[model samples]
Target: MRPVRLSVVTAAAAVTALAAVTGCAEKGDAKGGHGAIAVTAKDDSCEVSAEEFPAGHVQLDIENKGSKVTEVYILFPDDRIVTERENIGPGTRASLTAEVKAGDYAIVCKPGMTGDGIRRQVKATGGTVAKRSPEMDEAVAEYRTYVQQQADETLPKVKVFTDAVRAGDIEAAKKAYADSRIGWERTEPVAESFGDIDPKVDLREDGVADLEPGQEWSGWHRLEKALWQDGKLGPEATAFADTLDKDLADWVKRVGTAEITPTSMANGAKELLDEVATGKVTGEEERYSHTDLVDFKANVEGAQKSYELLKPVAVKNDAALVAELDKQFAALNALLDKYRADKSTYVFTSYDKVAEPQRKELSDGVNALAEPLSKLAATVVK
Candidate 1:
């Protein structure tokens, strides 16, 4: 995670090692680039100092000349918004770096930090020079493919939920609901990038930072209200489910292109644990269904997937720390798994079923997982 202190956490190579395992590493090692790419942001245009450059560890030095806040994106032809630095206030400079391969990509500057702004083409001509191993590269690729699969998997489950609602089967809809959200919650960050569609599909009713006043609330929460609070799946409820299903399908189609860095993935795992601690443990999510356990378990699965993919890289960097991370993750998952009552019955079906002691256990488990997962980002991301 980008901490309270920035600039100080330079992805310095870890100095420590696990005895008889991955050997020792040197500390104070510099990460990522030898030179910075100069970029200037103006009212409606973007200027890249170098139209052509070597492909490798490069930082974009963005100087905002615009009166408004600006952001820059390096967009690849494959639809990945590979890297970005956001909220560069007027007359200020901000930097973001990315490891890139030799390829052509579009550079976009978003002034006012709103719509996609001026775009220009840029090319990379040389080999990559980042200090990353093939093990790390292979892991990231596998993780990316897994994320894409999660998107694909979530869509069909959305249909199951929608179909149950459309059939006016409240019990069936309720059953399908929790299962449908697992894959969605796992790959949530990708869905969140889709602007209008994210709020439409999964935004909790209370989470309204970007919500426009007077806008009607819809999506899972909307259906949640009908199924749980209203205790019936009526025409309006079915219609809303249909809407959510469509949006979910759209997200499944669009999400494969999302940019997910190792740092973001590590941070995302920790954030999911935070979500579990703050919301799931408190009975905040699944307000009606009380199926918080399902979401909680799914979140752990997501976080675990993220960690496993980066496990080799982390072990190579700091073996003992990664071992701790692995142990904590296993503990949390084990605790959740212990509560299962067959395929249909997950750990605690409802928050009300959990005794005070059990709730504390869940909360403590999340905290243990969170601590190490949070540190994983700094250990690996440069």
Candidate 2:
């Protein structure tokens, strides 16, 4: 919807939105693949050796034969990228796991890492995944379904919020803002699945680069300033609202097709906490309206949900890790919960209101949770 605007003022936990949106995959190729599928990236094209693959893990051994830097994506149904690696300098060979399922999918390569790349459909034979255990397969499937549900929940409500803003009914927009955010916050990682949409929709001011003479920032925060700081919604505000509406509606529809693996989920959780440490803990997120607490709470809730859904699998892999995460999550949540202003909001006048001692406690707890959570991806592979 929109953010509350009582007076001239302003607000990752929201970076959970940023990090989730901007994060991509690359490590050692241990994430997926039963055998390497040779890929070649050239100045004009990306060529994968195989047109069809058995459902399961497959290595994409890519050589950037092209003159320009290139990146590769394993696109699932609806063009959702399951995994990608960027900046493959010419003549460099890179590898990543394509943890795929039985479905129709595509491989896309961006020669200069901009715009939609050339696409080629590849069929994935169903019924078996040689590189994935049955349990791991099910876990990924279940997480994908969960992300889809959150997207479904987001679509219609966000429409209402945007409508309120377009109508210039500021009070109505304010009322609808928080609820509209919940679905998005819950599926921040899923939002990241869309290649170009996230940064455009939820970009915070901190991400703004030194604009030359022409660049302009836009997104929810831009609109937040209009309503909260500027204290009025000008005619252009309607256009900003329109963009947010269109992007959120469009992305939610495609999100279900995204591949969500345990490795990604594990990495996503750690990244969310990192956002908390770097942005939320420091009060860098909510610059105008002071709603950083709102995003902070959402990030924790989203992280907790990720941990919960994967708890059984995690416990199976390492009970000790799961136990430690449980304790750390509880500690952090307990600290944050005390700041709850009311049943619905948090009390911090600003993030700076938090004493250094308390801030350190929060930071320490997030750090504690992150260590165990970061290990989750490899734990799943083992």
Candidate 3:
């Protein structure tokens, strides 16, 4: 998801934070056990405890002493994210974990949640860490397969949507819209990992300010505004739809090569919850279509899928956390079920139809799940 630009959350009862990528390390005892690194985030500086560590399953224990909510990233020398933890509020502390091979890397902290951020040089200085347990490797393999499957399924649905838009069939296009987004929403972190794809296909108009010059806002939301808000489907909209199809096709082809790790999967699950809380719950995501619940359900499903894949290792590390996660997922799912028009279909009541009190319940459900979910990466890596 894009960095939040709107002040809409102040009016809604939900978590006020930007959606971000993966996280690392154990709590306390930050003297570098279990591949731990400590970081202090301030308004003007990002201070990392050490620049070197062994390869594999690294954890970052982060403390934000800054006034603004911050974001932290462990990046490849090329600036691709190895893992990240975002929306760490003032005075809060968070732990993020990731696996890495021997290489030079950077730890970046973005205070106020904007710009390229302050950078600190770091390195993983040894050969590949010992192989994890067979089950852990299997979990990563299974998640990679799941992510690829979602990407593969998305291209065909997106084509149907694009074709409908081109035909100027308003009802058909509207019907296909939510279906097209489900697969993308389910595995958004994977798409986002590609760096350029999400901004092209998922960036909303409000996020335009975050883009560099010459980068135009295109893809689903642009077409969404045309079909719902503008109520017009001209050649321009059709052309953009075709472009969206190509961008998504690119995502489908590239997702298989995306980095997948046990910690990344665990952190990705938390990212989905953040997606729901920041976008879906506030109804900012599907502003024109009012289909936020469709995306909401898909986000929850994606989070649950990641959790389930990692539950075996996580349960071994912390049985209580697994139980809380299971409970929270079920609770959230049940709440979403209330709006389902039918159990067999993806159909749901439009988000605009939801009342304020109901929205609060949804927000509370998301926050409840998000807290425990944030610990998943560290738990699994432990």
Candidate 4:
């Protein structure tokens, strides 16, 4: 999970900026080809073209005019992510199409891809979004079922891992760790959409900088450090295990109500690849255990599952893109298989054991897949 840093923009400053932006804003439409919200992301500012738009399938045409790589998001008032497009390199242009319900939302651009991001308040006016075919509706239902199933499957495994940590069985916890994470990894974007859950369950030490004051750090990586880095399952580690269990249980119970859409499914699939690229490929996620490959495979599987579910509509929309996606998915999976210790198990060579050159190969594979995957949302929404 990417950390949420404190925004540099203070409340008074943000209010001033919003007032100035509101004066020049116009109402935009999503159906008449005027739904594109033009965003210019810079080092210190995020400028969006409009302050209001018709609800439905809205498109964000983003240009990173900044010195650093950036990310853009549409967030609810409470900061729940409606949809987001991340990892846009400097001087590049990217587009994101998202389904928005009529409500107040914020258009955000995170230059350097951190923090609460520079924010501009926007509203989605009451209107019908793009119509979906029956098949598309069915796909969303099936994907929802799949996400819930993953959560259901994950709880028992997490119990085993947390139980081991509580019992001070370091070896058993180490063995249970990777297996427990697979389900969560597979549906991470969905979990993250809830805004409150992922941080409690998956936040790493690097994310401590992003924590709000009075929010204590306790989760999987905290327990992971006790097992591998500190070489003991102390009292704090046991407490962290309990905290992780409680947070994840909340996630499993709440996941079914998460909003799932065809565009979201497509966008989420791309986000999974981003997770692999940023965390798994860099060997930063499972730093102590070096079981990054297990998470890597699960992320890929999740992306592929989303693509497969949307393939019918996507293929009907853009056959060439579908063909390319299929090819890249197969190729990347084949490459990952080379590192597998056994076909029957999720085990693979420890990430620390992976040479730099092999890591680059994996990174390249991710980028290759990511480029096309980025277009999936627009494809399915079309």
Candidate 5:
């Protein structure tokens, strides 16, 4: 869907005002001999002057003064401290405090809102802030082993569900399908750490129109609709369900055989994210349509599966790491909620009516989470 041009213009004006207020940084002989840094969001960019500061207790006066919501993050080499102010409205400001030590740091802002939104290579000459410790390599390895085991155990049930459908056993097929779905959902917390990997394409919505012609059905809901007419299937419905069952089984087998690993997850996620971004920016036809939202949800479920497989490993080695994983998972769920809500607004509506700024905001929100999600996949093991 494309956003209207007027929204973009409004967003640009908001960004400009934000930048004007945040572009100042002054070096004064304060208590700690440190300087005050100002950050502004403007013209769809974040501008920071003298981003680098000496190692000492520093105060960041972040002014949103923009039309949209914003967040500011201070990234250390190994750890990060973030402050978010939601819906800052217009002509508003927020503040953040940090005692950062001497090292490389990055200041980043929300997506599509202005400036590079990132200030890098800030040096700290004095400060007693704590340094971040490196994650243990062994912990990562242990997590990978667990993920493989979970995949082995759960992927096969998808086949069982499909097989039941092919055998014309509607009751069994439903039970099996539900069980498999539960397994996938249970695994989603960890699977999300891996990135975008769809377990199987569900052809539930397309019904049995092309079944006799050997064309593929596209969603699981289609099959369900065929089977349940006024809550019960007749004799003719049996054959239709059987055909769907066979197709599902075939999809399960194919997905099971496909290779799934951290590297593949990273690459696939990057590719999908790029596609989503391009689709949003250029208003081009998307590779995946709204009908594919269920499939995307399933892919996220797969990530949860990976998470289930790895949580034990994380807990055994580092409690803090597990906590961080949980935080990432929560953030991911929040992102999905926002996506669904925005997507619902666009459903059954013409693209031209939707505001461009809204589209950009949605795209930016997804991208904001994607980097961290991809990184989590690389870091997670088992």
Candidate 6:
């Protein structure tokens, strides 16, 4: 969707608060449960006190008192750095624990929020540091291999659906389209690595439809007619196609460029959930401009394309998969109607400005669909 647009004020506030917190301390006595450093953010900067930390492992407690979201990063002498939890919203704190060696290091808040929070330099002395063992290295390597295998298996299935469509076999096209939903579901855990692109919104709920009995299917037929037959695609239709292409390209690109590790996806998912939380909490109607709606629509379409790509894999294995997908499709349509009604009735100024609980309910409902839909991807392509 349209990149999340934060006001300059909000951005500055978050950055400043983060900076202040990171600068606070180097080491502190183990408190509560572990060796911990407490840092607090105020305004746009964070305040960190200096301290001596145990060398083997350390924990950082980041407390935010501002009105924006913030992230923390730790920089080391050898250019090795660790990004702490991100999108820590207002009034919340996150603790990050890591094993660190004795060395000079810097801590800073991420940019884009109050420019960048403060930075503090610290030196760890005295204790023995843990070194990576061969076993750990081997585990990491094995995980990488597994991710590559998954991607390799997924891409070809996606290609099958697209190739079928390109061949213009209406029946094969429909079956292939239905089959491709598995591809997206299969790669979702991997796909989550891509930042800000929500698979639930971008791939699960939108795209070209199967030649089946439904309004969604008919919508796809109408689009094809307008594009290939009439040779006159509307702005909306053109935009939808573009998103479909982009979503596919993104998946393929990740196969080579992305790390495909669980950590990558987990980190991305945290950021996404944070953004969704921020959007839900702020209730800023102005944030959902016309451009935002257009982006939202594109994301919905991307999710649809992903469904189309994996549908064949799903239907080939279980007819029930199609039924479930159709159910979600219908649910999304109903949600859209609710949003429209709320907008027309001035229920909360705008769709984005709906009550926090309502917004969260909507986001959670959509996200829940991803789990079952994702299971189809694990089934081998038939």
Better of 2 and 4 by TM-score: 4
**What ranges in model 3 sit over 4 Å off?**
4-36
lDDT of 6 by residue, 1-382 (tens): 1122111111111110010111121233323235367766555666565555656556577776677776666644322223344555677666655455565666665433433346666666667644434533443355455446655665565466445455544445444432343333334433443432332123211222311224231222333343334544345554444454555666566545443222223232233323333332343211322112222222333344445444544466678867786687557446545655453421222454455686666666555544344344323122
What are the clashing pairs of model 1? 339-347
Q: Which candidate is the best by TM-score?
A: 4
Lowest summed lDDT over 10 consecutive residues: which window, candidate 5? 13-22
Q: Give RMSD (Å) of candidate 2 vs. truth.
A: 9.4
Model 5 scores a C-alpha lDDT of 0.41
Tens digit per residue, CA lDDT, model 3, 269-355: 888888898889899999999999999999888888989998999999999999999999999999999999687789999999999
> What digit string (tens of lDDT, one per residue) describes model 1 on residues 287-379?
788888888888788878888888878887889888898799778877887677774555455777888999998898887777667677667
Candidates in order, TM-scores: namely: 0.66, 0.65, 0.88, 0.90, 0.33, 0.39
Better of 4 and 6 by lDDT: 4
- Candidate 1: where are CA atoms >4 Å away? 1-132, 208-210, 343-347
Q: Residue 34: error of model 3 in Å? A: 9.6
Clashes of each: 1, 15, 7, 1, 48, 42
C-alpha lDDT of residue 192 in model 4: 86
Q: Which segments of candidate 2 are over 4 A away from where they belong?
A: 1-130, 210-216, 341-352
Which residue pairs in candidate 3 have backbone atoms (N, alpha carbon, C) closer than 3 angstroms, thus clashing? Answer: 22-84, 23-96, 23-97, 24-96, 24-97, 25-59, 25-96
Model 3, position 295: C-alpha lDDT score = 95
Better of 1 and 6 by TM-score: 1
Between candidates 3 and 6, the one scoring higher on TM-score is 3
Q: How far does residue 76 in candidate 5 sit from its true spot (Å)?
A: 39
TM-score ranking from best candidate downward: 4, 3, 1, 2, 6, 5
Which residue ranges in model 4 land beyond 4 Å of their true spot?
A: 5-35
